[model samples]
Target chain A: MSQPTTYSLSARIMHWGMAFLLFSMLFAGLAMVQSLQPWHLTLLGLHKSFGVIALIAVIVRLVIRLRTTTPALPDSIPALQKRIAHASHWLLYAAMFAMPLSGYFMQNAAGRPVAVFDLFTLPAIMPVSLPLYGFFREVHALVAWALIALVLVHIAAALHHGLVKRDGVLQSMTGRKK
Target chain B: MSKKTPSALPLRYAIIIGAVGGLGALVFAVAGGLGQSSVTAQDFVNLQEGGNPHLGFRRAHAKGFCVAGEFVSNGSLQPYSIAPQFTATSTPFVGRISIAGGNPTAPDLNAPVRSLALSFGEGSSRWLTAMNTPPVMAVGTPEAFYQQIQALSPDPETGERNPERISAFFAAHPETQTFRNWQAGYTPSSSFASEIYHSINAFYLINENGDRQAVRWAAMPTVSNGETLDAANANALQDEFFARVEAQPVAFDLTFTFANDSDDETNPTVLWPSTRRNMIAGQIVVHQAMPESEGNCNEINFDPLVLPKGMAATADPILRARSAAYAESYRRRAREHFLNSSLQPSPQKESENNQ
Candidate 1:
């Protein structure tokens, strides 16, 4: 058995799809807070919808990742770099789930409806508790900022592997050859 | 070597970390006291205490006059709501028009916001609605409103707003800038009858099918916009409103605008777009304006939460907080009125006692 040269097609699609969704959610979240009119509401809905989609997508990605064999890092890669990559990937998965779940809980605790695209509504599970609502809201905001930072670091590492290191590590996810 | 079938150890670690992270967040929130309790009726009372000096006047919109009118429904509101006022051909109404601030003697032209509060129906089934000239609320939440009042209140030592304190508050809550900007842009209407007033809180309108839709309403002046008032005149709006109504009737089309998927149901500060679907439910025709001393408006609380069937309040915290605050203000004013009557008799009453 040999190490694979590239990621599976499904993995690549999920990676790119989530990248786009996460970035859009970040931008929309920031804009919504500043906007004082109908546009803010529009951005908020989009952000929530995308967040839910990301949560589901991350779960599927995790399952596929567990099932599929991944390409091993090049032998020349340092142990510290490998460890950092593993830790960041795990943290990203944690954040993907945390953001949407926190938002949903916050909305429920605030006694508000969580509608999906305004087509249907999710039942409020948490009792109306402002303390709980505030707690979750703060968590959601802090986690989002942390997620943004982690994503930036991930991009930098990928670019370093692709551009400076001239390694196939980046190509595994991008499906591009060195 | 094969990639060891992507060891489940990492997956297990990921799940463990995620759970730990979530648990840690809750612990931190509780420990750090980030979970402050919700705004209460006492907070509102404290807010009024900081800003309101006139005990008998409203916390805001203290200067006002009452008008007797009737609402003539267009019969088009059945599709949106089944509220009896919207269904009736004509429902008698008593309304008050007011200028924002706690000082009953505050010059009308200096008031940044104007308001209208109306009650439809003659008895227990009455529907009350309160509206203001601003299309959207200044603050989004009860907490923010409390902070705003504190920031705007005069300093105990200086008897003036502390510039640094107010600026810090604005910096912390930039959303309040929208309200300030709206106020800065306002041009005072010559008379209350010519100003368009908006119900900033989003409400749920239930139709005959029991299906609910979110909406915000506005009373659009049927009369054309009045000339901008001269700021030097202290009682220009009231004088003009009285003279205008005496010479001719004034009216407004009670219009409801449906909320779109993008409209926020919980935040009153976010104004729905003008492009949203709007329909005129009825017309409010004011036939007579009585002097403030003779008017029932002074006694009426005009609470916004007093809703009829087929209409419901949204989850907006600011809207919910308003009911509590209004009730508190009403209680205080009523108590003050009773005390004043007992301590100092009116001129007529004093003369009668002597005779």
Candidate 2:
């Protein structure tokens, strides 16, 4: 029987950091849609900063994973389950970039300054148009919903790995060994 | 175990580092460098038709024939006031027409006008609030109006006010021709007040029988040439209004032209023909020579929808939508003002440019 190796310190940090960013982005997006009041300006600023950071972190995370050899799953785990895990992880990565990118496109289409949390404006990425904005806005909203759904599944899978499967799948990231 | 490729790893790392640095610099540059003044007319992009679902949905919701708000006639104000022979009610309302721009200096010459119709009035009373630029809007729908306004704002790419885009809007909405006749002369370099016309899409007149009937009103500036004033004749209207009021409190009559049916929504460009015979229900005088005070002018709420008993608005969806949209605009403006106290600060403390 082989024990699972713990995740590296860098990987752990990236995971937690990205989690915080995603959570804040969700809240900021909600507040932006709800109201454009001055109070929300702070949240907007944070959101803008988060998006840029996420864009950077996602690129770094993918690079780091490619450079390091991640431990193989326990032999007891089915091949189907391994494949599922791989697919889900990549999906999460895709979502990280998709949400902010779509949002950027949406702002560009609206022709308003992408005032990220009042901290600064994003460079113009596109020209304003009714039809074009409509297209990007729809994509942005859809991506947001997809991300939220994926997040729910991720939390559920993490719990399942620990509680039902009684496997070290979830514990490896937590630095615990079964 | 296979070793990671040094070539791939460093390249990826470089890209990540470069992107982070670039993005960080951008965020700071945008935040620190762009001041409030940076939000020029160019920042406001013209919203495309049906492009912004939120606005489109709102405009759709606003469409419908609606009326309510009655004005209390002050019997003493004679031509301006309803007589004792007719019963009158007072309902103060607020109305405003704005050109789509972040700043006042943005050219008012060609952009579509957005009218805010908000009147706090009696249950059955409503007002036909409208814009001055477009004589008649496309589709007579609120959503259409909103979409139109969004489209005339700014170019999404360059963030500049584009005349070509506005011309396209005018082309699409041909009904705006009549209003075009009026807005053509309202150049940024010219005095706006002189060329501005007071429009009454609908009105309530207390008939001889003591019952209220619907009406429409308009104030055509009978200029020195009996035509619209050019920018060259600038400040003529402003000078006249101030000088007359200062010399002696002057009164102007707001005559009412009643319409039997309330569906004047389609024909806004056509002034409800006064030849059909409208009684002089009352007149409104500039009773006081009041200078333009920010507090007084900006805060005061006026809606045509506000009316007294015996007076009611006709069935016009555009008018109906105005009630809600106008109120929301003010509500948002008030909130914006509260959050950013520096907005429209005291004239003395702020830049002379604000004046």
Candidate 3:
């Protein structure tokens, strides 16, 4: 069967939406760590809200990805390049899910309820354990850094395909394929 | 016609994604548990030990008097806040009036600032507030304050602070110059009541309508009767304070000033302008005074984090840090007899005749 030329509509929406949310999360997280201003609390709430959104979006995106066929790499692409692309894509997915799950559990371990935009409280799923809280907190931070690095690499790869190689691979996700 | 089974691609992707995600989580859990450990309660204990050789003294404000008082509410505060202490007609309070510095024997003449730490209400509903004479704090964040303390701490071998370290800290944290200037501008008050005590950290006041306002409170003396004493009478402030309060209650107007858009709630080092709207919350009347040993103040931690309903702490790192330091001080003091000895009533010394 011939590979699709572009991602499905649902896939495109989820991809862009997650991109905006994750970017906001990264900046908010950084600001909260550096300063303890009155707005810091507000930013923290937003960060947590975005994290939850990212988690849900990633799950939906994963399901959609499983049902739909991803556009194949151009025939000119090297086998090594294709393998690297496949591995990085999976790693990004792993980081996206890990960041929020770790943060949610970390807060629970610290004996705090996760309030989504102060609209509703998510009950603590785990018992209060300082050690567990420390572990999860570290994991959340470390995964965030890893995710950032992966995102930069992904962006670079896409630019390489679009600008350097003049391949249609980048346009497959962008929905700009002719 | 040959027809292939429905493609197994989706199932294969699902398995691969699940396995990779599970593996990533496992790696993070193990790496994180081994890599980052949160600061423990022991760190605070160690910090205190490193700062002071005198194990029984407080980490700061080592010299103080235990006083009994009542905050008489004018009832005007009811609209702005529902805190019982602010709205009630009157609520009895216990507090310590102390001078800045960790030396219990530090002369009142040389002390840079005075402090008032009070606990209002009784039992479970009690609230604690630690205030100082300065309108703003010396340092903004907990880390900066901690570094300041470390910079000023005496060198183990020299038994005096290294000048280079102190200068480096001051140069790096230029904001602290405001606090230092404020301190240098004032002479030590002859009485704690004569000085204006400010709750340097900003707090949220939730009104009856559920409207929240950011405010910092101050207790201004109603009377200016305290007599200035010279260096020869270095110990006169506390003595005179006790004598005056015993003769008549010393009172202060408890006022709250609302924060404007320009105000920085997190940085206590930044003082809000006086032009901001102010309201008379109540009056704090010190009816009686006693030496630290005779008063119940030693038992109280006076952590600013302890708040009644309608009063909440802001994201001020210094305020949050105080809670932990105060707790550790209270814990260590409670365990040792030497620390509790300061609370034991001592015979009053003969007054020096220096008019």
Candidate 4:
């Protein structure tokens, strides 16, 4: 069976860019939390800034998706696999947007300026509240780990389709066999 | 299933974006906006440097502490200590120079860090704490700052700084390179007084007109101006500070140079190029001295949050965080001292042994 034509050039670019961004952000976040030298602050700032960029890109990508249809999965693929793909995609969207927002809220709640690179500042959207701050912090932390787990699962599923299943699902996203 | 795509977002979307952006910018302008809060040297000296209202002196006091003193350096041998009530007045202030640690005779270059404080007065209002480091740190997050401290502490197994671990951590986190440049010739364990510079991480000041500004308190040793530590001149740094205090009690003055928000923001690190543009606003004098025999040094609480009007702390997140952390650390140290009793040896005893 043949694979259908896949994502547009713009969609593919946004997808891959967002992927690289999200993964780099995850590592940078981990490093920032793990290190404390004066420079780690730079890392945290970069992480946050990149996270915001990914989020914006995600929004634009979503808009593009709404304006242009994505290629459908192969009919031969199992229904369960399709459902997993759909759920994972939505989860990535949620994470790409939510993580940056959570961090922004966290800094704002602490009365800190949210600098993307110290280049431009993002305005605070919420007032300071210890309880709400704590809630967002917990969510931010849990979401980070959840995102990590989900990304790992994503990698595994993609590999299963590409290697074990030798299916075109993974290839479609990568634009390798569309 | 493949579905039909929707059309692009309408021009209304761009209008919505512009309106949102415009409204946000306007509100920021009204609220002093982005530029309003960027702390200037004038802000520090003029004492107009307001903090996040939710976490200012009022909130800090609600959480259990208040700004007790604002010691501004008048560029004299004597620095003045302004109480939260004192304003627009300048006088000679007392300054104390010492080595902080378990032992008294240790070399200054042995330590990777040094702290210098100018005690502007004889009582609770006397202290302005500064480190011998430069360029403010980048770790804006409180949690990251704390974790970094633990990582830098003496190794649990070796009872020493684990070089491999420290090196790896430094390599992994390259942001420490600036600090590393400062620490290259210095050791992690030494008498602080012997170092060429003494600093206060976040210090603020007030001017003649009761205006406030944010400042870093630095003491450049006339004798030990270079990075390399001279064992011979070690005593010179301490002796000069004490001799001047002993001669006139009011002889020495502490000076403070203003750090505008722009310069501060650019280099948030301690290395603010002290030699170049930093300005000295006021002076302080030493009236009376506290002997190691007084035994009250342990009870002393040197908090940067204790600013007077005409001298307000900036919204510098690190300053805000450190004020709370320092207070908590001070409290915890006091509690530990009370509980252990023998945890810290007397500096007098150590000094006598060296003699």
Candidate 5:
């Protein structure tokens, strides 16, 4: 049994598309809560819309991962490092699901309905509860920081595989494109 | 998959690329939080009265309370502007009255400048304003203001401002003279209810006839307390304000003093002759004021550029600079207060707090 050379085209597109959306959503969430700028209101709208989009995109991404083949690590990498990589990938998937759900719960707890780009509003699943809102707000913020930290580590690993080790671990995603 | 690939880069290029990428990320991170390398808004905030880093209060006018009110138009402004507030219909507004200073605990009597900032309506229809006790603006331009503040900042080691430096700067920027004179005769208002708040920066009012009129506005207290109120209480002004409002609504006559063709609409520090016709725009009645933590105005930015349809910003650089500086100030205060304090001010789009 041989592993594939790179991710499928659909996976690559979803990967980059969701990458931009998630990065922007994080900053928007941070700045909107931290400031009272009206521009932040628009950001709040975009953040909500993009969060929903990312959530849907991640579901598709997970499905794609299950159906299509994925590249395997090189023989040079350690078993422990491989296990860590696999675990971290699962954690990233967990974060993608949690971020938007936590935000939705936070808004609902605060007695505010989550509106997606003003296209339509999501029915509040949780009742208005200040204590619960605080709880979810804290969770949202903590998870965001954790996710960012994880991303930085992931990037560092990719750079190492590509630049230092000169392995195809990164090229599996980049596909040797200029 | 790990396949042995050709060396992606020369060692020198890899090191250079790594160094540049790291530097770029560092710069981006810093810029994202603290703004550009040469930040101006925080600098402006530092020069404000009682300006200092406070845990959960504004960089200026830290001592204040929230207020809810209505702008009841008297129809006098219909000729000057096409704004909805002038059409004789009552409109809701959230406002804040504050003692000018960065220190929230500053004594009320020590406040030479009082401020009133307001936000009428929400979303696209919102009109935000900030006014101060001074009849005219002290600093004409943002450049002059920056230089003046730089001069006013005390020596880091000595902790004493050089009087000669201030004098020289003022001498160089004579446009600040009107405000200087106002400051020399500074007196705390008898009470918040009796204070007059002036919109020093001129704003244009576009009428139905396609006429653009630049005017300054004021919220003149309906009652004159004549400096009879006691100042011994640290929160004397706020105490009296709350007490009076608890009994009956406190009110102000909103008047817009039209600017003459010869007057300098661009310079805020320059005062037009007192003889200019001051037309009553409306009456602002503040029904009540609550502590900032409990008031609706706590989250409001009160950026002056949030004007309604008929009103617009003047070419005055200070007006635009004020909008920018206010945003920076709001960002700092909101971040500090929301993050550091236990109070959860449920984030709302409709809010107001300014100085």
Candidate 6:
């Protein structure tokens, strides 16, 4: 097998696309919960629709990540750091899938239909139950905070790799070819 | 893998980085929760609409009719704010006129507080959320307001407010004595058509060249009637307004008043000087009022913080508290509706599965 130095173009595209959508939804959801602006409903609609799109993108991204030849960590990295890096990445994948699914089910438990930009709407699949809705809402909110915290660490690590370590790790998924 | 030299992050510091980030998030969640500790949004929602809220209703202004109208500005506030609502543009809006408290059945003529909540649709400016009160508010902070509500709340056993708590609140805030004097001399308006709605919190209006002017606005009714509404009839107030609107559009001159340099913009308890100049910024002609069943303005939060580009909230703690409390109120009411209208399992689907 050939040892690749960077991620493929398709993986890079998916990474950036999902990153934009994820950040936007997080901030918009925060704003929507805090105020009752006229534009908030529009924000809600976009959040739901983009969440669905993210769900699809994540599935494909996961497949690509698994099938492709991922660049190996540098020999300078310690064994403990490598394990932690691997664990954190898996946690992120789980969170990416969990976020959208919980929100979708929360809406389902509320017995409200999810509309995709007014083009189409999906009907509720679960019976209307307050407990279920509450559970999902809590999960959605908690996961959001966790995801935000994780992203902060992730960004710092990337900066450390690029600037401090002067490693090509940051360029692995940033479209820079070796 | 490449020829370039690589440096590794220390294992000890990597864990610390994530741990610190997690700690930061936890701190934010605790510190930035709603409003002040004593006067949280959760507290307001629980006290007012807690056990069983009226589905699809506001926690405070629970009962109100929706008004559809067009705001016609005279461009008088051009020097203070370039907000579209202050320009000579006619902006369509929907609003509500409500009384104080969570109980929708509260008597209209006997209402201690009359409220006006408006959302300007075409214009980006936030809603003009106000109540019919003196130029200043009764309390300096939202914590005081919440404490006053708590003190006045009827005791479980006695069904009367605790005299000690009431006295303690009054004694602690000597500034509230002015409110008592104002309340003693106040007179109730016979109709919603006559009462003037005052925005208790002050806002800074940003003009061209980034100059800031502190200002307040009120919706002053065009016509006043000495006619007293029927105190016995629960629907009498709404009926009167609806009937009057059918004949002619009830108009209110939307006016903005500039604040003096010495005025205390942060404290709601201190009244602004009467010598401050007033300019008629616009006129709102409410053509018709839709019933609560229509769900027009009934669902709006009227968050005062959702201002246009040119307008900004001052350092008034009450204003910040209002945004948090209002958000909590809207969320609970909307959730109540969502919970009440949950999907039921169909018997037909079960029978079809049996096949």
Write one digit per residue (lDDT tens) for candidate 1, span B128-243.
88999998777887777777888887888899879999889988987776677777888766778878899989899888898889998899997765666667877788878888
Residue B342: error of model 3 in Å? 11
Task: List the candidates ranked by lDDT, beginning with the highest.
Answer: 5, 1, 6, 3, 4, 2
Best-fitting candidate, measured by lDDT? 5
The DockQ for candidate 1, computed on C-alphas, is 0.02
Residue B69 local lDDT, model 6 = 90
lDDT for each residue of candidate 5 in B1-355, tens digit (9 for 90 to 100) = 3454466456734765575577457534643653332435555775663344665456667777889989999888888888888888899888998877676777777777899998885433458899999988667666676787678867667899899999898888777789988888876667888878998899999888879999999999998774455757777788788888998998999999998899988788888998998898789999978886677676666778767667877877677677556645665555555455564332111132331
Question: lDDT by residue for model 3 over A17-116, one digit each (tens)?
Answer: 8888887786566444434233544665577777777888899999998999888898888899889999999999999899899989876654444667
* A63-168 per-residue lDDT for model 1 (tens digits): 9888888888887898998888889999998998898899888766544455566455567786644345546767777898888778766766775665445567
Minimum summed lDDT over a 10-residue window in model 5 chain B is located at B346-355
Segments in model 6 whose C-alpha atoms lie over 4 Å from true places: A1-178, B1-38, B50-52, B122-128, B342-355
lDDT assessment of candidate 4: 0.49
Task: Determine which window of 10 residues in candidate 4 chain A has minimal summed lDDT.
Answer: A32-41
Question: What is every candidate's alpha-carbon RMSD to the true fold?
Answer: 16.3, 17.2, 13.1, 17.6, 7.3, 10.0
Q: Please, what are the lDDT tens digits per residue for candidate 3 over residues B1-355? A: 1232357445544554555555455444533432222432235455646755344456567778899989999887778778887766899998898887766666886777789888886422457888898888778876677678778878889998899999899999999977888877866566777888999999998887888889999999887756656667655788888889989998899999999877888789987887999999788999999986677675556767667667777888777656545645544544443224433322132122112
Residue-by-residue lDDT tens digits, candidate 4, A10-45: 888898887778767766654444232335435655
What residue pairs are clashing in model 5? B50-B102, B300-B351, B300-B352
Fnat per model, in the order shown: 0.00, 0.00, 0.02, 0.00, 0.01, 0.02
lDDT comparing candidate 6 with the true structure: 0.72
For candidate 5, give the lDDT of residue B297.
Answer: 74
| TM-score of each predicted structure versus truth | 0.56, 0.41, 0.57, 0.43, 0.68, 0.68
Alpha carbon lDDT at A117, candidate 3: 66
Lowest lDDT block of 10, candidate 2 chain A: A33-42
**Every candidate's TM-score, chain A alone:** 0.94, 0.86, 0.96, 0.90, 0.95, 0.96
DockQ of each: 0.02, 0.03, 0.03, 0.02, 0.11, 0.09
Tens-digit lDDT track of model 6 for A1-178: 8778788888889888888888777776765565323344456668888888888889999999998888887878899999999898888899999999998998676444566765666666776454466567778888988888777778778767765576778888785743
**TM-score of chain A, model 6?**
0.96
